[model samples]
Target: MNNRYSNKDVDVFAWFREASEKGNAYAQFNLALMYKRGKGVRRNDAAAFVWMRLSALQGIAFAQNHLGAMYYNGAGTKPDDAEAVFWFRMAARQGDASAQQNLGLMYRKGRGVPRNDETALTWFCRAAEQGVASAQALLGEAYAQGLGTKRNFQLALAWFRKAALQGDASAQLNLGLMYRRGHGVPQSDTQAVAWYRQAAAQGTAAAQRHLGVAYAEGRGVRVDLERAYSWLRRAAEQGDVDAQFNMGVMLSNGYGTHKDEALAFDWYQRAASSGHMLAQYNLGGMYAHGRGVRRDPAEALAWYRKAADQGAANAQFNVGVIYANGHGVPKDEACAVAWYRHAAEQGDASAQNNLGVMYANGQGVLHDDAEAVRWYRRAAEQGHPLAQYNLGGMYAGGRGVERDSVLSYMWISLAADAGDETACNNRKLIERKLTREEIGSAELMTRRWRDAHRTRTV
Candidate 1:
């Protein structure tokens, strides 16, 4: 609860005097913990073993747990899982909630005995009933996931609520998500923000990330760039890859701080090293654009390929673009088409657009206007600006489908509305095409989309 050792300032020899003279259980337990940890005493396992045994003999629950853990982890004692289980059972029987939870975990994992889900559940329930937040949360997960129990969402919600109310940050975050999405709890953004903020303030990484998102997007919490950036930065410093990538984005934007491309590069590198896919994609972009470092097409290609291999859609799309254009690697339209198709299947609109272009041009595979229209339509449905423009172009030219002037004009209007500048400008040449109303609608949609999904906290 506090700093690890409670008696950090006390002398061990003096403590031994008081402990041995009075046969103090707490003093014995404390001494043994110290000895086991070599905190204020020499690292002597035999001595620690004897002290722990003495304390264990005195029937101190905490001592029982410590002794059990020592046996479990072989600290100051020979490895003996059975003995650990014995001591743990002894402590658990005495209503030690931590011991109860430990015993449950042991049984579930078969650490000291045969795997017994029923026994594990029994011990978990015991600790859960004692108001151990971790135990309650674990029990909740077990019930919800049908791990040694029935899958019961209601039971999960009940236990999660119990643990959440107890100020367990993990439970608070989990329950907040449930509330935010109305999964087993009534949907309430306000309630979600309250719980998320509480856990975020307590330094929970996931909660901090969620809070950053909320602040950035003005969801539940009013838009606060500084607060969002601070929370994201805190999480990033804790080795959270997602946070690192988002923090990089903020650094790139000069929001609430100067735009420092080098810092952005550093954060991106951190996240990339940790295998954050988005960071890998962004890292490639940095190399391609020469934002923070010298431009190296080979390095950009390498990063894009790495992320593409991990099934990152944007990375795949970029890989296709670079390969097709011979920006980094030798010109290979076939390779570009392959990557674009892979990413398009994962719903990358840019990839779909590029794939459609390849099909229309016959740059790699056989030229097929029909396939072009198909791919363009897929991306257009998801509001891809370029794909919408191309799909409208196909409709107007009757390249794939039959000519229909009215339908062709309608598609151009939709493309312009989707924010395709080319589609809007071309409408001037295509008589009676997209009206002024379509362009205004497209602008509004694009702004909303950008604001709703913050690339970073800022």
Candidate 2:
């Protein structure tokens, strides 16, 4: 590969043929380059392979490495991995850094050799010591992941920095992640963004997406929706699924660009087809509301089911609603209960409230006031307004537990504070039932509950 070729209109082909006939290895390599590149010769991979093999037999390390690559890639010959390993070993023994890195890759992948991380690490180290950028990146990953070495974040960071300084895009991206996560280095969003920008400029899709998110969220930089959209669009155009979903959200919400439901739906569809659960959920809502596409209950149900299967709580709740309303599917109270339970188990407050309603009315589950109160209390603790109002009614009527006016007032007042008009009206009526001391106790209880819930959320 390092051999020089004359391009001064000389008859280089004739000169190579005469020198090759004299058994000169360098001349054979030059002739092979001519055949490979069609320089002063017709392009012929077979001829190139033949001449390279001859030079490689003369112990020319670079020629041996080229021959190995040709065999490995089946260029001008049928693929022969074992033969490629043989040639790579020959060149690697002569201190060819490229061959050493290639051998390390083969050993790591167990291609034509037993998988041996230690051996792979040894070869990688050899190449890295010689300043091979790719080998340095691989060494960094190996150290970081504890592959054939003890996990060493500092060493990993050092190696990544070396490769990044040499313009290795992957290393730059990994270096950014390390800085973002404070692995071996102090957490610094500014440093992370700097490295991400370097990799993003080199067309690293993941880096572009991360950089876009950082810009949009004002992480280590001023919030710039336009810049975020630009970076995310670049990554999305490259078929990054997460970027596609993000682009859909931004477009739909008009975050950094004009609101474009049609474009948002397009991106959501692309991501949904790739099995992005959130995209499926969003696409289902779009279909349900006729936002960007024709309103179609059946299509909406189909998308919701896909997301629900992936454990999306909102999708599960939507599925329950569709079944209960008989929209696109047969009205099945049993199916509604099943979907609602699924969402409720995942802590969906709306689903919890709906489950309580179902239990209280015997619509889906057995009529059990105790179960209803239990579900209502779960939702109310999460600050669900409807559930708090419902719980207040239960406590006042003694439907599930003994009547406690103070508890009833506390629940209703909490709901009322959240702007529930019905609860606000009921609280005033309940206020007349309590003594002055009871009202004070109820108010104190509501404040304590609010503080506890706020702390839990934070």
Candidate 3:
């Protein structure tokens, strides 16, 4: 009698029961599968385990692989990684492809044995060579990331293509990334979108997120805010952090949906809770400005601090401002200086300008004109109008260096050109202190500086 039955026929069940009870290994394995799947028999994990173990003991490689899965999943018995490894090894030694893949997974995850990438790669290679799609994908990732072998984008692409053709979602996602980044293939946003669509169709959250970004940025297709919102919502619903952040931005700006600050706040809160730095910073802004929630400076500071801890320069600057202005806490210039310095060292123009003020006024440190000039120059070079005006004042007073009326006039004129009203008035006052030649020289310097920066930005 055939061991496998296609239908839930009563006679077939009886025949399998009889043969299984009579010590037929194939019949036992088939009966176990039927019980496990609730096909010809009611789903009974204990019965499945019993029959599977019996068949496995009879040296059936397939039964051994199934038994290992049962133990690993705790379907019929307490989860036991060691026992799972044992059975998986038994079937693997018999050249069972599934068993080899399972063993590789165990090694890769350190579930039943010491985490060993080399061993995992070895087993994955064997199973991949035998045409296991998942194993092929795993091997591809290993090669791409140099996990257990030298990084080889060509080999990774080959393996990913093999598994992707077999409809592996992970392989398709990786292949899309490879194309997007030009790894072992010419960069092609269109090809990246094609593979991303394939993987997204299979419900891969990462691929959905990528497809959403591609739509939003018009990389591979025409800019489609509606489609971007749709794909991002799918991935965000699946708990993708980046997608959640993007959803917040879209909702806030009414990109594809109606403008809804409340919804934007909720999405930002979700992503912020997940440790997304940008989300945290945005959430702080929402709280501080009463955009979607109550205006709460304390809450804003809390969120800003969280992002600041993650090295967000904007958040650090905000934290410094909050401390300096006593927005939600006691006014502490020392704390403000510390936070400002943190952001300043990271090249935050606003923070650098603020730090210069703190130093010049001796609010947090001893008054140091030279130190103030140093920081003001850094921010001024970045085209911060306020810093340029302040640096010009330093030159006019000779606080940091020898007084130079022409240089001071040039800096003040640059600030005035950038639309600083105070600088504009100050430039008029400074013009009276210069000769015709000095004024002409200052104007020429200003023009040269503006042209150089304009060219650099272009």
Candidate 4:
């Protein structure tokens, strides 16, 4: 059996006596903290204020900071931002790093003072230089966004690396992103995978999800769908929204394990209940499709509307599909176009491609080939396969772009190689007219693209 009395368990009168007689600053501070936390003693704001004031008078920087927190948080007392600032300044001037960083947050959030990004950055820099991992990450965020200083990816990466090395999970994730994106340094998928693994091992669900994605895509390590699916499951179990959504899909499709629609629906429900927009959209899909439950268009529409209200692009597109198909409701082309437009505004490649098709066919909106071409181009830039084929056809036929058989041949064949049936038929037609050399060049590019993107599992 363990017999221990926490500092919070001490009798107030006994502590006061010992503290007053011995002039024990640590005891005084601890007693003050107990009062602040209302442990063992009746909660009394005035008493906490008096005890912390006494300890602060003894040059206890910790006590000063505690007082600052109390004032800042308005715990058991009137909110006094100015007093909070004063106490924080005292402790910060004493070289207290926690106070410095917290004060910086206060200034940044305009809690105790006007929002002064510069002051926030300066204080964060000071604390970061003092070897505070939290402050280092905060400084990195500031530099990354140009909040107070000029945006500097290099500097942000440096600070994030330093903090990440010190076991800061958020910093680790940021550093991993920089490695994956080649923002400050040359892209190193290997390094990104390493950092993500470290953070994931520390129980970071976001890192687990990203690491799984890297594993699945073979960004650095050999692709392993089993490992990716397992990692995603771990993150999903911990309530990670993105992981939950992705895991639901994997379960529904039997990507790395046995197909289990019931499990997929359960996971989707868990994530959607937490206000995860994508999960909500996916839940709606399951209901609409009758994959795991009886088909219920009303329930699907309700979930789709929830996700759309939260500004989820995929949900906006799904809502449009539901309206157009009259899934469990009367068909409404006007509403379909409206939802499609919302998804299109958010740069959803599928929505852009579909919306363009809708316009061209006059299914839900005005027939306009030019508008169709514009939307298709937008989707093409995002690597949407269908849009690439559509753009190639437009170029070849002079429908919405300048006629260019050479470019059309390249794109149509490119799409065909990626499994587009229509593009393949057009490719067969173009192959006979083109010289062998032109065909070879297009073939090489298509092969290269396929080779670069094919996900081979380990």
| lDDT by residue for model 4 (120-227), tens | 999999899999999999999999889899999999999998999899998998888889999889999999999899889998999999988887789889989889
Worst 10 residues of 1 by lDDT: 449-458
Return the clash pairs for model 1, or none.
none
Best by TM-score: 3
Taken over the whole model, the C-alpha lDDT of each candidate is 0.82, 0.93, 0.94, 0.84
Model 1 misplacement above 4 A: 1-31, 43-64, 71-96, 106-120, 143-147, 150-154, 164-167, 383-385, 392-398, 403-458
Question: Clash pairs of candidate 3?
Answer: none
Off by over 4 Å in 4: 1-17, 21-26, 34-50, 57-59, 72-83, 273-275, 309-314, 340-458
Candidate 2 lDDT by residue in tens digits, 85-114: 999999999999999999998898898899
Question: TM per model?
Answer: 0.75, 0.84, 0.91, 0.70
- Clash pairs, candidate 2, are none
- List ranges where model 2 is wrong by over 4 Å: 1-94, 106-120, 455-458
Residue 316, model 4: lDDT of: 94
Query: What does candidate 4 score on TM?
Result: 0.70
lDDT of 2: 0.93
Model 2 worst lDDT run, 10 consecutive residues: 1-10
Worst 10 residues of 4 by lDDT: 1-10
- Residues 212-261, candidate 3: write the lDDT tens digits: 99999999889999999999999999999999999999999999889999
Model 1 lDDT, full chain set: 0.82
RMSD of each: 6.8, 4.2, 3.5, 6.7
lDDT of 1 at 114: 91
Question: For residues 225-311, could you state the per-residue lDDT of candidate 1 as single tens digits?
Answer: 899899889888888889899999999988656899989999999999988888998999999999988898999998888899999
